[model samples]
Target: MHTEHDWISTPITADILRGALDLEHTAHGVLPHRLPAWARAQSTDGQLAMAEAQPSGVRLAFRTRATAVELDALPTKRVYVGAPPRPEGLYDLLVDGRPAGQASVSGGNTLTIDMTTGSAEHRPGPAGTLRFTELPDGAKDIEIWLPHNETTELVALRTDAPIEPVPDRGRKVWLHHGSSISHGSDAASPTTTWPALAASLGGVELINLGLAGSALLDPFTARTLRDTPADLISVKMGINVVNADLMRLRAFGPAVHGFLDTIREGHPTAPLLVVSPVLCPIHEDTPGPSAPDFSALGEGRLGFVAMGEPEETASGKLTLGVIRDELARIVKQRVAEDPNLYYLDGRDLYGEDDSAELPLPDQIHPDAATHRRMGERFAELAFTADGAFAGRGA
Candidate 1:
């Protein structure tokens, strides 16, 4: 019931792309990387490498009048062993910077991951095509935002009309760094991530450094943040450190200071907002190194529980409660010396009241609805007049 048009296959090259800092040509196609090649070389582990290449903010952007389009991609979708099935990785299409349509390709491949065993299995599959038909006539910019959580390889781009690079519109750049939540945890798609959504609402170009399981106040990450150009910047702190129980109180404060110091080294006056972690009742009072809820595992449900007792905090263990207090203190102390520095409590984005109505489904990551709430609240706080980062002119 479909008729074929004369498809123009465009070269899948980096010159026609944005958001991705580097692209690796694979045997089958090209893999987009959010981090640069030099930074990727400094990856300490496979986890960091995977997270860096996940392309949380990467998109294929161009201007065209194509009525129909086809994109071939090979995506590695993750399936947690013994856990509930995850949604398929979604590909979102945008025309003239407006949402147009979305699609998911099945049979492309799958990655079965066993968290308990720390192992994974990859089963190869063929590249799947995403087709978009009946686009409105006339020239308009189109952006295809890849799935944030899945690793995708670009194979080919086909459109009914020729496409060209999108012209710059002189939008302010907003660079952000955070953990999984900011990295698109439980987000419906890549373009809907809190940072991405907030960027759209604020009309800023996003340079997201949201590394899952790896936003541990790393010196290199801070250096990357310092080097990236931006009109506004934010760093959502505390969640990953608390969940991983990576550092104790003694080391946490100094590490934060050093991280901010590194960023200030390059962007001394850029409007920088420091955000604390959103509420996670499990870790609110209890110190963490959160562990899996085994009871839920039988039902193929994945959830976490705070393993460390609150009493352990006296020994310098960090809890979400403790981290919030510490972050507030650090920001308050530093704001006097750095006038452009500002702090926005994470609870303001997702407070106790909101959590009561829209609880975190995994006892950690918020659901898609909550992601929308957080993004909306952030835009109000950071972009509106008289808000923390509102005074600066781009």
Candidate 2:
């Protein structure tokens, strides 16, 4: 007698799929009711708390059934990060733990994973689509690794499923914006970014807009958010603005207002959150040049200091603290009319306690461990059922 395996067109259930496509929900009535499809089983227990301060690695794995194989399938996989470095290798497309392909790392800093037929190499460019082909028939598991050193964000995923798209069963969508810190920097994988982790814990979709050196309340960014669809929204300000001294109070306030206004155009009643910056001793009260000190490290060492002369602060140049204070003030004013608006102090996400435990190797960005801590705090404060922003909107 001969036995043979049969191909079945069984529908994939939410329980069987893993990795970033999994959905979670922390609170019941928050704004955006869908989390990123890519956030699945993370290291964080549902508790979503932080204790460490250095960078830690995150690995996300999921299995899916393939009915057939094709040469031209544009599968969409989006990974968000806080300031992804230029030529940064953050995505590794693997099949059966073997290299399927790797994302490009270029001179410009942006976190994106797009797969195409090419040699296994890391290239760089803006955040966008990743294509994969020649998949082995049957059930295959795909793994996505996020940055290990810096924070990261995960936005969305799209694939050509012969079946109708499954309705999202997670919590509300969580939109976030910030500088490179929110972008993936020195991360080992795309799924391990802190924002991606937090979204997993909170159970919400993520719309990450953490631009490198460009989170300075740009009209284009605000317009992007305004046009995009979301249920919950957040803006992580400071750090970049202070380090770059991009604008003074005269312009920063109005610019922030305008930014929020544009977003409100799309999500008038959505829960909007405003976040400040994490702790950086060098930029605490000083400003300018957020670069690291390569010379200070003897070997295998990284050092960082606030750029520019110390006297710049005296001339009304911005500092991290200044930006935080202003952000708080702006949020307060907006909340008066927009009750759904909320504020989360950056220090709360990563404070002096964390700084003492996890000193910035370069005094500029947090390590992998710190990213985990930040993600936990964010999920706890922003996504918990009893959290501050919970139940504010249906």
Q: lDDT: which candidate is best?
A: 1
- The root-mean-square deviation over C-alpha atoms between each candidate and the true structure, in angstroms, is 1.8, 12.2
Question: What value does the lDDT take at residue 17 in candidate 1?
Answer: 74
Clashing pairs in 1: none
Per-residue C-alpha lDDT of model 1 across residues 1-394, encoded as one tens digit per residue: 2358888999888767766777899988999987777777776677778787788988888889999989989998888889978898898898888999999877777889887778989899999889999999999999988888888999999999999988888888888999989988899898899888888888888877888878889787888888877889899999889888999999999999999999999999999899999888998889889778877786789888888988999999998889999999999999999998989999999989998999998899988888888999999899997776674434
- Segments in model 1 whose C-alpha atoms lie over 4 Å from true places: 1-3, 391-394
Count of steric clashes across candidates, in order:
0, 61
For residue 158, model 1's alpha carbon misses the true position, in angstroms, by 1.4
- Residue 181, candidate 1: Cα error in Å is 0.7
- Tens-place lDDT per residue, model 2, 113-213, is 22122122323333333344455665665544433332223333333333233334545666677766775444445544668667766766554555545
